[model samples]
Target: MSETFDVIVVGSGAAGMTAALRARDLGLQVLVVEKAHKYGGTSATSGGVAWIPNHGLGGSTDTREETLTYLDAVIKEPVNRERLEAYVDTGREMLGWLGGEGINMISMPWPDYFAELPGSRTDRSLVMPPWDGRQLGDKFPLVREQYPRFKLFNRYSMNLEETFTIAARAPGWKKKVATVIGRYWKDRSTRKMTKRDRLYVSGAALIGPLLARLDHKGVKIRLETKLETLITTGDKITGVTVSHLGRIYDIEARHAVVLCAGGFEWNQELRDRFYPVRTSIWWTSTPQGANTGDALIAAEKIGAATEHTAEGWWAPTMILPNRSASNFEEVHQAVFDVGRPYSVCVNRNGDRFVNEACSYDRFGAAMASDQLATGANTPCWLVFDAVFRQKFTAGGILPSAIMSDRSIPMDWWDHYIFKADSVAELARKIDLDPAKLEDVTRRMTEYAAKGEDPEFGRGSTIYDKTFGDPTCQPNPALGAICKAPFYAVQIHLGDLGTKGGLKADHKARVVDGSGNPIPGLYAAGNATGSPFGLNYPGAGGTIGPAMVFGYIAANDIASRATNRDVASAREPVAT
Candidate 1:
């Protein structure tokens, strides 16, 4: 027997949930199937910033013309102008709809990754307000928790403001630290009693309330259900064959099948085929076993067109040995840490390739571009000094209050962290030419002292300074790597996820190779060919488009259904 729903949403991330919720609001029976045990996909572990331009949040003054102009400046060829326009125009409407559903949101003051871009605004991003996990009641356990390393002391989840306050050593730092500890203790007590922490922020906060809303509406979400294939009638998708707990079930979609399943970051074969630089699951920050591009493969099997297959939302990542395994590894994205004072990334030839303070996407892109020339840009070394170790956290290693033998491990120093007492010795340890490395180190030291990086212009922009130490003079990002006992960690090609997938039209409908919409198929989020093409416009670039297109898909499906019902009503009676 086959179960039937007005809409079947594949994947349970922000995109899938948004589609399901919108469909349910339109009086449609919606079913969401997730391959993972938990509901939220990568969105659950993300920072939860939605880059909705001209959203009017935080008194943003962004305009549609400005946004289009910015898109023209950043996005590349094979661009879908219609889809991009739709996203910019309808983004505010989607936010309004979500807000009406009692989902609390606040303006995140983070600037656009490309603040210098024409349409960029500092207050364009919006994030979900902190949520109390206890409100989810029995369902709290099923919600996938954020990665342990992302939290403070693996206990308290801090917001952007709190993170900056502590990192910058702002006024009342002691009081803030005490408050965090106190909250962690309270959370510990709650966890002991109920087996779930109460305070949820970032991605958890974004997803928790949406899940709560879904629960309130009695929406059916089947976890551990993997989509095996799409059941199509001619060129139109009608249903899907899915396997749940080793049991295969055929499910029918009465109106539409929405694919929000993630991209192919975990699939090595696809990475080798599409990516400019070959990558692996070991490098991505996405949730384990979640984004294998199953949906993308399924769509391709039905002749769905794809674009931007060579691109990903890139970020330089460092593997943490303590959290790695044979099949999977935990990756810490080197975002703010790399841009802070006392740090610089160098290729195998011991040369700086890019502005270290730029956005992660640009940083990774620079590394990939450099690899095309020398083939040795990846596995690049992130070199830093004793000052960086004493002042900031990097790759999950926290700053030490007192420098001692116990503070720095012998095994770590010998294996993961290459340490040397001098620049020339550090070059020798890392297999770089002593003269070249020393010269680069000397130049960096000179730049740091002058607070100017004429070579790469580190800390030249507002976005760069956002992650830098405010205490640093002239340039917050530049610092002399002259301190003794310099340290280095291997960084690799990492990403949030691949941006390319099944090509989608303006209505979020999956388009065939001939450029026609496949009747009942739709895709959004990372599962669809990104509307941004090659450019990452803002902080929430991935999630923003994912949500807007998901909403668009739902609205289009709902409108089509209404029109069909109207046509059927006008049909002549059989005589």
Candidate 2:
């Protein structure tokens, strides 16, 4: 830990650490500086699925052109084609490298969130390797011990749809009866349940192995080492100035400097300036320290150019009123994905605004109307009924794990999530323009009756199709959201982090305004613009790009260093 070596990485998240580890493998010394007093960075708290194409680990020879074709459909804009190709090519190479690093990769061959799109390969779009967490030693706190910076995590993922599905299948009368008994019993611990009752989510799966990989690397990670400034030499970067342990240290970069600090999701000032939604009441699945846009500011001091700083990774994310304190868990799969026999989500006008089954990314974009966020994107409601909430989940999720009140009770439910005895009363409570809601629901009922979608075109994306319930006849992802005594729950525009940042090339070299590489500087993960460009097709898509670029940057730095050593030895001392 005392010696400085070949590489000095700025953040210890997946990208930064991966870069450092790869550099070490290339026979280069590496040092990782972390600002949060932990080694995992944002990746420690991630879903951990790496979206890779044509993994070499499996000996797949999938063509690069096929990969590009798939990427083209997802990303509407012309991407840095070379950088994207590097992502796919190096992603495959990196997968094999992980094997040598003692990581066992696991692949799940399921439909992709964009399977409905072109070149959507249902075969292994994402993977997670079994890693040894014991290797982290005393630094495991930096890995598994830290929960949300603000909240406790004895709850489940509310954003996930399956929790609602389980809750809805419990039988309406059973849920009601259980609720009454739950009040009298006070502690349900008296009832015996299986460990399966405690769910394991995607985030936990990813964070575990990520820590293991760091432990195996023998890398010294200093948390709380905030990157304050970049040590620049004229137009090039030389070293870095970090404030760590209450003292500022001038550290030199022997190889390459990579910035993996996350995007500015929690910074209210930055969010207000760059993002579409303007609010101090932002809700995120990210940590509070995510406020630090150190990478953006630090790189800017030395004139680093970036891409699309206006919009973030926007998603039509849902949130509870004061329930922001906790994401209550319940089961509501039927409402959001199934289109079940009852219920539909409506906005303030009590009208259906988006395909209820759209991915959070696409759905969030469509929710940005002319009035909200100064004609940007604001929050909307997910409406349903007593029969539905008591039977299924509204918005198909329980923002957290436990609802203070399990049944339909408050008008907090109105704007938050409207529930009424009649369609008319629900309309009055939320101040909807009656004609529109009535007509919308009437048509919704007809569609549910036929088990088809027409309005917003639900079940169009592979993501929507994955949420489908095949047991209901046609597509489980499609149906008419029609059940009487409807309701609506409010959702906000939320994000894990923004994807737009310093543009990088195939080598993961930071690019300038004129599209030239910034020497001795590299960026990966959310600190750089997405390799997926503007399109985020599935879950883990972001994580895969982060890992791939991390490896590429490391390889580039190591190869150049080797060549530089050869050049320096041949030259005589000028002095």
At residue 271, candidate 1 shows an lDDT of: 88
Candidate 1 stretches greater than 4 Å from native: 187-189, 194-196, 323-329, 402-409, 563-575
Q: Cα deviation in Å at residue 495, candidate 1?
A: 0.5
TM-scores of the candidates are: 0.95, 0.81
> Candidate 1's error at 355, in angstroms?
0.4
Model 1 residue 88 CA deviation (Å) reads 0.2
Write the residue-wise lDDT of candidate 1 on 20-115 in tens digits.
888777777779999999878899889888888867665668788888887788876768889989999999899888888898567877878887
Model 1: weakest 10-residue lDDT segment is: 566-575
Compose the digit string of candidate 2's lDDT tens values, residues 111-167: 555666777776545645433333444443345332321111232222122333354
Count of backbone clashes for each model? Answer: 0, 43
Root-mean-square deviation (CA) per prediction: 4.3, 7.3
